[model samples]
Target: MSVRLQLTDIKKTYRAVTALNSVSLDMMGGKIIVLLGANGAGKSTLMRILAGLEDPDSGTIQFNNQTTDAKSIRRVSTLVFQKSVMFSLSVYGNLAYGLKIRGVPEGEISKRIAEALEAVRLSGFEKRRAKKLSGGEQQRVALARAFLLNSNVLLLDEPTANLDPNSAAIIEKAILAKKSSSRIIIMATHNLNQARRMADEIVHIHNGEIVEASAPEDFFENPKSEVTRKFINGELDF
Candidate 1:
């Protein structure tokens, strides 16, 4: 089934700072939408809102045309952080935790765990300690954990930032492989090359608002906004 996520007039604030201002967007399944912006540009804030980790000060979210709340969104969305967060346990144990809580059959959990590990290219490391793995390995494990949930919406914040080239490439490949007609994948990144390579559509956000959104080709070659031009030319100071 195809899924559609719509955000309308979303606004968020943190004390004296406005994190998101009248931000609105629409996303559909089967495409990778890259949110391109510098640090402190509200990308993370918007992601958190989508993930149900934060409530917008003013906005409406519709899933498949039905108005929804944070609780409902949380059930169908998964957000992977920029940093790798792992439990102090074996990789298998970590991956099994969610399934266990959800009472998934033991056999089914094992099968899914294996498939998820293989997706991240860490199939045989299930017995290893998650925290003991290298940075790249840990991040892979994190991605695997998120994938295992099979959420309809996947939100990634700087997914490959600060990683070695190989790990980044592997993660990117895994992400692309996961795209399907029933899922919507949104990634936030500042890396122009990565965005250009992976994004079907690119949305530029600056100062807590969306500047423009377009296909990658037009986003780079024929930007309509001066802010986007500055961003493309490496002139935006954040």
Candidate 2:
């Protein structure tokens, strides 16, 4: 039941500067794809576009083989930001807040909240103040919140940057544990090893364009692009 999300000839320009130049890529569902690039390399920009938070100057986004409005697409996508916003509330409160905001029924909310916490391996730290939690704990809270949404897609930006390896692994496990009946997960990461560990497809971006797209095995073993070669060899900083 996995479906592919397609971005066709996407272009974004800021004032006189071009941020993305006709970037086209296909992302298969039920698999993780890592977008690798340096700072200001349009990685985040592309994620934002996929999350429906930014509008491309030109291009089309098709989800599940159908073109649709951004709002509809957003309903099926979860965008986990680099810096998550935690409400001034308890961890349990934050975890269940999204369901509350969405007006889920009380019974369903309770069930979903519990399932989400379990999914993120945060079964006990419920009443703790979110602000007081460690960075990793707070991120797990966000993951729980997102999981409760049961979205079909995910867009993450540097999710493990501030997290300890243990906590990062927890979140990664959560992402990978989701039901693959119909889902897609995309992340923009600077961590090459993590990318290799998680991504099914490796998308190499530079300056403001996608230069290489390949399966993880091929991208690592036989990269075709100059930038990708330099990247795999750690010659390029990004």
Give the top-scoring candidate (TM-score). 1
lDDT by residue for model 2 (23-82), tens: 998777778889998888899888888878878888998988898567877878888888
What TM-scores do the predictions have? 0.98, 0.93
Off by over 4 Å in 2: none
TM-score of predicted structure 2: 0.93
lDDT of each: 0.93, 0.84
TM-score of 1: 0.98
**lDDT score, candidate 1, position 16:** 92
If candidate 2 were superposed on the true structure by all CA atoms, what would the RMSD be? Answer: 1.6
Error of 1 at 94 (Å): 1.6
